[model samples]
Target: MLEPPDADRLYAALLARDPAFDGRAWVGVATTGIFCRLTCPARKPRPENCRWFADPRAAQQAGFRPCRRCDPLAGAADGTPDAAAGGQGLARRLMAMIRADPSRRWSEADLAGLGLDPSTVRRAFRRQFGQSFLQMARGERLRESLRTLSGDRDLIEAQLDAGFDSASGFRAAFARLFGHPPHLMRGPADLAADWIDTPLGGMIAIADDAALHLLEFTDRKALPEGLRRLSALCGGRIGLGRRAVTDQLETQLDAFFAGRQPRFSVPLRLHGTGFQRRVWQQLQTIPAGQTRSYAGLAAEIGQPSATRAVARANATNRLALVVPCHRVIGADGSLTGYAGGLWRKRRLIEAERAYAG
Candidate 1:
């Protein structure tokens, strides 16, 4: 029973057949058994055929196929608290426990004792989260386990430390997820992260839960890989680790989202080719609110003919606002490729521009 937006707002968008409202909400046609974003290019169906929902995942469970034009699988506009909680209000708590000790194991009875039916929790998670509770729980634990293993702890200790009842389970999960075993994990100890909220949505800063990791858009394709790199670098399990870096980064993120030109000085942990890193480093010098072109950055980096490479590097940057890739635009002053999606890039630039002005 999630309510749609104001009736007039929805009505107005439908009358105009607007595209801007597409990801923010959806229309489900009971008659046709299809769901569509407002931007779906298909012919607008009759108003009587539309039963609206805020997201397509819900509509899909109700048995509506997504319109091909607007692939609902792009994911919802940042999960809401209810979406985050998934009705049990345990997402945060569970996330906390997992982060607190990624290697820790909780039996079904233990989880059920926390006021959740194991089967009900499983179904709710699968329906609302698209992952079974155990799977989600396992992935999270593996992250932390990997993080811990990468540290001073050796492989066997790290394996057992990550809460795997046996070394075999730990090794199997690691090999499956990272394409390698724990010994491959390597990197510095500096943690990095930054948070931002845009008109489209909010995204958390990614890291080893200890040091800077990936400064990713919540909805990007390579975000998962970025986390893997961070976990690999940390050589330990990466369930939300408690760190001073996270606290400072969280505060700075709040300021950034609030339109403040806040100074952020967290040490960075970047992962990319030497060329990509060079482009990103140049990007960091673009000032808090000013922008530059890829051509400009390429030339400044003494690679004047590498404008395209620079663009590709920028496009591949896992970190978003911190590296200031959003500050790079086309030579024509038009916006260009941003992995976080153009909408978020536009919103960040606008917010920063106003701040600078």
Candidate 2:
């Protein structure tokens, strides 16, 4: 567990019931052995009896039960509707409509027509997604265009199909974001990158029309270099966007983290040499809640003498949980060489073990 926060600041937040600190910190009362959110409505505890934790998990690990009144795990200040919920709901509804028909060009006038405040919708979407509604819609349109292009559709057709009114405008936007014009794309077309938020942290997912190329925690030191290598290997530019494969991967990850799913079915676009691909494929076969030594993986891949090579391939793997590289350990059974950090690797292995039972 991490060290607790400053006692004075946490106590101030607890006394004021600050909603801003809702998920950031939890206060545990030593006398009652209960943990509550910073915004808990219950009376604040005295300074001497209070302890601050970074998260609910930490509080739980410290032997504190959740307080019934606040239910800090739910990620809301109280059971009542939050001030941003209505606007957020409307933004989500609008997003759904936009995603359902990527060819549609939505505008502020459309929101007004729907009896919604345009500014409120914009603010809510920006707050939740960190982008304007129009930007997201454009990304969706670009994703659709890429999918169409993968199907051998012509550039003009793809542009119109993606809701763009002008060919030049489409070409410019595509080039600006992807670092290349759409017509210049060759081969199977590489992957688009998207961010996925998980309980552990934010992850970067890269995918194309047909398969997921990579999924790695954002904090991995080698991620940027790996992405560059993938772009060069696939002969396609990487841009900020999503594809059908990425969306599916996100859903599967959500289930896997929730312990409701044990395997991923999203197709993979393994971008590596035949030997490395074989190593990654073998890694997937090492079921959840199990660990394999580098030597074991080398043997499984029919290269028993290439344990070091197998370990190197595992270290280079960009797909983290889906590829199960974390399942590979040292010959002595110690966790080793996970780019996502040994702490995360340990937690992932632990979660899988508990779920597998």
In TM-score terms, which candidate is top? 2
**Distance from true location, Cα of 203 in model 2, Å:** 1.0
Could you tell me every candidate's TM-score relative to the true structure? 0.48, 0.51
**Ten-residue stretch with the least lDDT total in model 2:** 75-84
Candidate 2 deviates by what RMSD? 10.4
Q: Kindly list the per-residue Cα lDDT of model 2 for residues 274-356, writing each as its tens digit.
A: 99999999999988878999999998988999998998899889888889999999898777878887656655776777555
- Which 10-residue window of candidate 1 scores lowest in summed lDDT? 81-90
Backbone clash count, each prediction separately = 21, 0
lDDT of 1: 0.63
With a 3 Å backbone cut-off (N, CA, C), the pairs that clash in candidate 2 are none
Q: Give the per-residue lDDT digits (tens) of candidate 1, residues 1-357.
A: 012345445655766655435445677877778887666667777776777776556777779987777665443234444332233344445655755765667778877687565775564454434445666667656656645754577777777777787777887776665445555544443443333433333344655444555665444556656666766766645442336665666677767666664455766767878998899888888876688998899999999999999989988887677788888988987778787767565556655754566
lDDT of 2 at 356: 50
